[model samples]
Target: MHLPEIRRSHIAIAVISGLLFSLSFRLNQYFDALFVYSAGISLLFLPAGVKLLAVLVGRLPAIVGIMVVSVHLGASIWPDKPMTAIVYFAFVSLMTYPIATLGVMRLFHIRKNLSNLRYHHIVVLSVVASILNGLVHNWLYLAQGVTTSEELWHKSAAMALGDFMGCFVVVAFFHAAMGVLRSARNPQID
Candidate 1:
């Protein structure tokens, strides 16, 4: 996109999402669990704001880059083991973002109209994204050295389920964010 147009919006969304996720981080000692849960919400809700900014600026690449870098940095500094966190970020970006983007685009016939995707489409996208997210977690576990194929599969399944749950949370958050954005964009007679 135009870069300039969306830069402000992207920054705003990133800041807000980062703050919200940080709040989640403080809520529990099981930092990984809390981060993953917050991540799902962040992915679903945050992307739209990013997309909005991208469209305005015509700087999709910058938006994506910012997201990847932010997530990577977050993972690098997370309380959990650094390696595991990096793996999680990689999976979320590589696998999750693509799958969710595809599933939602296909389901809604979105045609890349990122600015106006329906809420349901966003939810579907988030679900797919979450599934990919879980896969990444499982992959990380395996990379640490899986003893058996069955163990690998088991971890994979568990990660998938966790991703799905996280996706759902993200979808809910996305809808709320969309509503707020819509209201702000169209304040009317009351």
Candidate 2:
């Protein structure tokens, strides 16, 4: 059985991935949710360069950094309790990765660390993770005594979509670039 090696280069890409995600930041006043996102619908619907769960896990530090900055951007959503917002956001980001990773493993029968995932597998994981992201964020809103169900739904959907889109866009770009480089070196290869 082949095991996945933890490449420093990949890990570095992970860190940089967070930066790319950060570049996706934008505000949607309707939901009062400030978030970073990429218009990656084109790639999100398709199977792109979705990395393995273990590899993504290795990028936890960078992911956490991105989460901190992202949450801070929306601190005004809970101006009176900014700390509460930060803590909850951080907690969700930390907890989601492990739980979702387990979900991916069970759902896809992937026991190997950092093994390549199938396209459908990646899509399934993306949807599940998005729901988890939305649920946690929405739960926080409810806990804070917000009662507008419609707005709650909107916020959750926006946040989930933003994250998903950003990731998808980044993956698509990376794969496309690699393909271009590979094709350049081999004229016969397509």
Model 1 RMSD in Å is: 6.8
* lDDT (tens digit, per residue) of candidate 1 on 115-180: 666667655665566566556655654554432456666555555555454455555565677789
lDDT of 1 at 139: 62
- Per-residue lDDT tens digits for candidate 2, residues 24-112, read 43322222223332221121221111322322444465455555554665474456776866677656654664577577768778654
Q: What range of 10 consecutive residues in model 1 has the weakest lDDT sum?
A: 37-46
What is the lDDT of every predicted structure here?
0.50, 0.51
For model 2, the local distance difference test gives: 0.51
Model 1 TM-score relative to the real fold: 0.53
Kindly give the stretch of ten consecutive residues in candidate 2 with the minimal lDDT sum: 40-49
lDDT of 2 at 66: 52
Given candidate 1, what's the lDDT at residue 170?
A: 50
